[model samples]
Target: MKSENNYERIVQNSKKFQHSQKNEMQKRITDLLQQLTNGIHERNQIMAVSLLGAIAGHNTFLFGPPGTAKSLISRRLAYAFENPQYFEYLMNRFSTPEEVFGPVSIKALKEDRYLRKIEGYLPTADFAFLDEIWKSSPAILNNLLTIINEHIFKNGDERFNVPLKALIAASNEIPPENQGLEALYDRFIIRLLVPPIEQEENFNRLLDSKPSSDKPEISEDLKISYQELAKWREQLHKVKLSTDTLLIIKYIREELAAQFDKLSVYVSDRRWQRAAVLLKASAFCNGRKETNHSDVILLKYCLWTTPENRETVEEIVMHVIKSCGFDTDIDLAELDREKESLDKEINKELYYSQDIYDTVEMGEKKYFPVLATFKDEYYANRDKKYQLFISFNKFHSQDTFNPIDEQGNTIDNIECQFDGQGSCSLKLRGNSYHNQYTPLTFKPKIIFHKGDKKLDVNKRLIYSLSQAVSDIRKQLIDILKQVEKKYEEYQQYLQSPFATQVDIDIAVSGILDQIDKLNLRIKDCERLGSLCR
Candidate 1:
């Protein structure tokens, strides 16, 4: 009797050990998931439910199109729980709810059990998959929604709830259009768009993956019993929320509202409540009770469900990340370019005013001829070569002639001809033909060399002086233009090289850094894709 008792004790001990091993494995899985993603509220939703399913002994929806590895996530979730009850469906137009919910357990119906026999499928199964979920009709959609949300199936007056964990719905497109879209779309608490494997290099890696064999049915093995999940469901609900994470989610919703104006967003009281569950679960999965940033990306993953929203869903998520906080890289160059345009406009309007033409033309007409007379001593003291002169003195000597109006009446004080008010200027600008006589050079040469000792004398200069005075005016204006050109060159030298460089260089450097940082962030993402591939 003692020996028999020892064998029974050993058997009982062995069973306890197996149960303990399962619990330990589950705890480890929960811990591993917590570290894998950022704890953004959105991500926390995905993580929470994933763990909730493990605890609750249910499955989750791994949504999105081909190559995004939507099904892979489902498989991983099942693997994580060490629960073999995870099932996946790549749905189509022909798929019926019964196909996923299981045939009314036809064989059992014969046994007089009116129950849709719930032998397998979603109602009785631990986890289930439904791909292309939107393709189904309102009847099917409504049935599934009721089951997913309530975790209960109705057979006539009888209601049966199962240990359904999570429903990962996948789709290549958005929820169908029409009035019913809202009703069905609202069921997916967490929507995620799985994009194609990015980068051509990752293509080969995906191709190499032997598509997982028909996901071993979710009913094969379920570790956490339904009773155990219910025990922790309240605790999961009690998960703490940090103030910062809440603010971020609110901000994301606002931002999405702006970008996704076409599709209306009406997050219910339930969504907010669930979001907390997700945030907490995410922390739990990663072995953390505290939320953090890495889980944020998972939240982005959830916003996609319909094919239409996939692009915008990811876009909204990335924008949050890039813009969050003070760690942003600014593109100074683009800013400077925009700013510099304003200055250019000001310069064009100010100094380069259209009114300058009027000013110049009006100034030309305002010119008054001047006249002057000076002693021979005064003339000799001046640069003889400037036989060229400003002739301001011409004003003093000129006879002022007054001009008349059209009626030839004297316009006193107005410088009209009848009033004898116009002024003629002559400052003896090196007298040209003041008297009809021999060239001035001939007289100068003869006076200087009374004896015939002539070296080459610039006789042509005398001829030049003898020429008409109008020709001299033209030559003087030409010389004035050359002086203006030189002045402009000097101004350019003062303004360029260093003065302009310092300010622009700083701004340009800032812009370059902005572009550089964005590029680096993208590269890191690409690298992540490589690792995933």
Candidate 2:
């Protein structure tokens, strides 16, 4: 009884935890996000996700044409941090390493040492944006890979720990294939397509509004400090991936593997590790202890490799996420198999497998024979061998049948009309021999299980089957309750500062659909249970 009370207490605590309100940190983050994204039209998703990438210490890539506000979004991201050292550069083929990393130090050059003054450059900045990144030469791109991946820049013989929190890169086109830029490209895990304003109303608002500032007026209290960011990064590692999120990831990997030939999409183990960090950071920022389906929906932006396969990869991710509902910890597949096995056992024990009927043998064919009483009394006094025999099919049918001899030969001038009440009238030799002829002892077959069985069979099999169905019904009801509770908790997910409303809706809708499916399963189980009675 004490253990039962403890279990109840645990359940109540879990319910409270699930429905808890957002914390102060989450509220501040939400307000900060709104300040950063204010006056931006149709760019909420990109801006919000970019900020998330920054908070998680992941690089971002924006792919689109020149006038798509890719640079603007990157510039606005620095405003989220306090006094961030921001950097911006446009790359071309003629760009040299000295121009990007800073010109070689003249004072150090006289000492026969190669070194670069890195002040006011990419390596020293906290947030950087490189536009037209693919246009740069290999010399600049190779060093960039090192900086973005390890957060370390080597100036001559000395390596510096770069303060770069997030490096957002923008490009009009992806790097050319076989150019050996794939490694550098893979470092940017959060990839988004920054397109022009899609809706006409938003576009008109953009046309009417004045040019927005590169840095928005965010309050100092709202702006994240370096100390806070560092502390949050440490705390982000503690955010666990929930079972549902892991299941969604596994399903996505399986689906991608299945479509590898057509999609040519491959996600590396390192990339997955980085992506998991991003999801954990999202959970942390939202004041949750674990990731959920809402965070899993962000994989659509992270998994695509190129613009061509972007839609296909997004479809694969969303299809997997939408198909997988909340985790109920019950094996539905095992329940279905058990139900099937029980059905087969019930059929084997209670119902006949083949048709059952009585017939009389005549040569190679079988017929049903009946006794006839004639008005002439001549045939009635004959031996039993003179009894009328008809085909089995004709005996069961309502049609008129002719009588046959004991040798299976049809006898002419003998017509019989069955009254469908186990008796028939006969006309013998064209004379009115109106007599009632009753059929022989015959019983039709019983094949299906209509719950009519012997007492022992019902006690042994049907009772057990009904109990099993009841157990399954209980399991389904439990799952339905859990899913319904998750549906209620969706409002908390919607309050997340990182995930967009559209994404939250998709995840919530997918999980809510499971409630309907679970109710259907419970009803089917009830039906199965009723069949036993």
Candidate 3:
């Protein structure tokens, strides 16, 4: 009878949980965020994003030095759940599987059946935190990947479904180059930089405060059970995503892939799908039945692999978000490519030679074009030129018979001879003539001509180059206009009389700042266009 009553109680509570107002849910999350991030404004983004990722059922990785409240945030998050069953571990290179998954059951071993006692370990927890996570051994690392990715633990004969809602991991540094670590690294969808306090005032405040001893009193209204979180996740699929939201996602993905060749950054298709889910959950948690532009700001937390890449990815995503739909169709890559081709074509050089003529006395000393020909031996220089020379040659052949020792007695071997000789002098162009008997030497002088025309640059080529620059400038101007128009829209949305919502004022400023910077780039483009002309 008691068990039946308990079952009925659970049913009633679940119904109440499912029907809770969206505003109330957001309020609970916000309340938790405020308490968790109190007195630390710099790390508030990290805190808030961690909460959202956890609520969305994705793993979060905190990377920073040792003392920046990485474990504190996880503990705060674990405390937010009702009757939270938690697991926390500090891993090292020698850590074994038994330390994480719990020891093998001796009774089961005696029975020749293998099984583990996983009750108090990560496999049965509502939330878990692993510190220095990259230091784990392969034996522990492989099983860790399976549990995090599949949320299932295999214990001998049976597969046990892990009850974990969130897993928070921290590391002083990213894993060094190693094998078997990539799969574990890829399982964490959200990576955050948890830098220590940099501001003097914040640091002084930290010094004045006692190490946080008071847990935010978890009111019944603020507490979320694992079951309730599961139900809310089911509702995420029903959250409306507009066509524009999908279009923005597509554009961002393409841009990221394009930048990867130059930036050495890459994101897999699986991460992209998970990113969509996170955006949907962001909307669902913020009391909205549909996703809006604001929800996508969460993507800044989801896309980067390294801290340096984090800033770049945020810049790209914010640019897309800020454009508010006008940024599409502006393929800067293709435009830049066209610009390069024109630049190369305009600067290339060409060369040609003109023919020269010499006077040859035919009928009456008429001048005509001379086509040179060579007979016998001729030599040319490295530049393929044969120097002109003034020269003359004479040849003689003779045959004589002995004064006939009277009657045809043979003679002195028939007496035959041949001889040749020549006189020559160098001739220079445009010099006082030492004219030889020959009027011309049949050597045509070679001359070279060079200019822009040799490069094939004409009015048509210049006009095309200038036209391309104008087109690019026009494209940039169009994008700028859209950015300004979208900013105005965002302002009106924020100031609307019916607005009773979490204002996206920060995102608004971020987008406007991005637009302003884009306008500056447009000015640069204008200067570039003029130079191209």
Kindly give the number of clashing pairs for every candidate: 58, 0, 0
- TM-scores of all predicted structures: 0.47, 0.80, 0.60
List the global CA lDDT of all models: 0.46, 0.80, 0.65
Task: Provide the lDDT at 346 for model 3.
Answer: 46
Residue-wise C-alpha lDDT for candidate 1, range 1-533, written one tens digit per residue: 54354345434433443344223434454344543222211232344445544453333444545656555555555543334466666667787766766666566577776556456566765666677777776667788878867778886458977666766676666665674766556656565435565566556654665654433333223434455556666555555555435645777788777865675544666655655566565554444444433344445544554555666766675556434421222332453353344334323422233211111112223212212223343334442221211222222343433423333343342221111232332222234433222111100111232222233434563243323222323333343344334323322111111112222222223223333443444343343223222
Q: Which window of ten consecutive residues has the lowest lDDT sum in model 2?
A: 438-447
Of candidates 3 and 1, the better by TM-score? 3
Candidate 3 per-residue lDDT over residues 395-450, each given as its tens digit:
12122212112232322422212222211121222212331121123323333333
| Clashing residue pairs for model 3 | none
* CA RMSD of all predictions: 25.1, 7.6, 18.2
Between 2 and 3, whose TM-score is larger? 2
The lDDT-based order of candidates, best leading, equals 2, 3, 1
Scored by lDDT, model 3 comes in at 0.65
On lDDT, the leading prediction is 2
